[model samples]
Target: MIAVSDNLPAGARQPTESGDCIDENDARQAANWVAETLERLSRSSFRSSFTLSPHDAEYARRKGRELIDRHAHEMLAQRVGAAQPAKDGRQTPWRGHPVFTAQHATACCCRGCIEKWHHIPRGRELSAQEINQLAGLIMAWIDRDLAAHPAVTGERDGWAAPPENPKDAGAEQGGATPQPRRRSDAAGHLERSRRHPDNHHADGASGFIQGELL
Candidate 1:
């Protein structure tokens, strides 16, 4: 993981007063809206539709923070001049985080989605003002999920630890095998849950915004 810079450039702090970042009250309001939407969706036949899998939720909570901290400035602050595809064909800009899945699921994954869902236009690069606002919006969605499901995530165990020896995997003396926690390392790039593999598809420049102001 790239080391996150502690210093944000000028005008990069989360909004406090009625500008970029959503204050506590604003976050609460946004969370409430999402909760309500979820509640309504839960009542429908597609009750299981919107919720992330437990494994996916855990991965998102952990890696989303890492991805945001490591790359949000380059993603949201600067201009995306062209689509840059990695070796595997996933666009470099938006790959590697379940947050993009959340963004796609939440209609915040690309500039087109931003335009379609939030009335933000394309063509021009987002200003730092807009960048912080959108970043806060994505964060608010993540915060709401974590707030609702606290047990799903906690401090991550070391990702770099070596695997247990195969001979020891079966346990020297075992009556019944314990169900192990699902864990995964993505070709050494990211550690995630094996049950829920990383959804690394980029949303391109579709959603540069996330969540709607209430």
Candidate 2:
């Protein structure tokens, strides 16, 4: 795995309000939190299992980072930013978008997971700064996934070559491609139960217990 520090440019610290969420404006702290969080997440089999499929990686490349980041922010804000999201734990789907997978892998999928893994408290709407931090982390994961899988851009292994113009890439695909099968609730519960005992904790504290918030 590429070191998280390698992906981010080093910068001097800046003042900010005290909070558990990483200060997105502080480049150094954000980089460290991302690196540490990723490292901790890697120790969990479930989190490590999530990856950007060739198609998803290609989709991200075509959409460009700006659009992907926008999608992440929008999803996070709509699905998770609310204090009492309509469905809470069931809000984020197990598939359909790259950010969804990233959310699961990074433990940013629900309020419970966010509180446990990210130290972001629940019972109140996520602050704008907190939302930005979460978005940054999600984007960092996507960036890492893309960097790790360069073959997605090449015309090999059933993957199509990237188009010269990103906007034109969608038309080249003909139409909207079908997403992979969504994970059934039963399957998700089963997987979580199977992996619960093996979940990794940060700082020796207990890790997220799947279905706890469901």
Candidate 3:
């Protein structure tokens, strides 16, 4: 979406010459690349701020990894993966789903971010292998977040279960029900990043690194 200059950072890893198609060796290399990339991304306060809410974690768990993987493919193909997407930089939302959060956290939300962070080039449609690799990266982030905050079982503090039939239960017994914790949006951080260019690499302790998958 946003077409920032494609100037790679100093000491940045070079993009592979294998084009868009990734081979077995590429996959192995990609694993290491993803680890290093995520670490660098975690240094940015804006990028590390995105995390899945309990509801999102529950949804991912209920849907299973297979469905989540499918969603990754569908989302990548529809929202990204194209040479030039419909909205480009603004195509991805900041919240509403785990995958969306993962995209932001992992820098897979747009073409510019993808190229800047993952060494993936722009101006051409992403290959199936490339899409898959990106999807894998997204899933890896989601999995880590889910694992970091295990599902809260039983009744949470200050949360009360609602009656099956509120009307039948009568107004006397009805009481206020606590809402689920909402996932935080990084819009403020994004804006800060825009105003303060140096904010992109601001020093911050990221929880993701500790829970990163091997």
Which residue runs does candidate 2 get wrong by more than 4 Å?
Answer: 1-25, 152-161, 164-177, 180-214
Evaluated with lDDT, which candidate comes out highest?
2
- Name the weakest run of 10 consecutive residues (lDDT summed) in model 3: 170-179
> Residue-wise lDDT of candidate 1 within 1-214, one digit each (tens)?
7887766565454444234564456556655765665444333221122333344444444444645433444444432212321222222222234344344344445455455545667666665555545555555555555556665223433212222335433432111233334333333212321212223223343212123211
- For each candidate in turn, the TM-score is 0.42, 0.66, 0.62
Model 3 misplaced regions, further than 4 Å: 1-27, 152-214
What are the per-model C-alpha RMSD values against the true structure?
13.0, 9.4, 14.7
lDDT of each: 0.41, 0.67, 0.63
lDDT of 2 by residue, 136-212 (tens): 88988887887777743455333333755544345422134455543535336436633443333222435544433
Q: lDDT tens string, model 3, 1-214? A: 9876677555444443233434456657778877877778777776776676555555566556766777877788888889988877767765556687788788887777777677789899988778877888898788777767766543222122122333323311112223265534545644542343232222332323235311
In model 2, what are the clashing residue pairs, if there are any?
A: none
Model 2 lDDT at residue 195 = 46
Task: Pick the winner on lDDT between candidates 2 and 3.
Answer: 2
TM-score of 1: 0.42
What does the lDDT come to for candidate 2? 0.67
Q: Candidate 1, clashing residue pairs?
A: 15-21, 109-207, 110-206, 110-207, 110-208, 111-205, 111-206, 111-207
Arrange candidates by lDDT, descending. Answer: 2, 3, 1
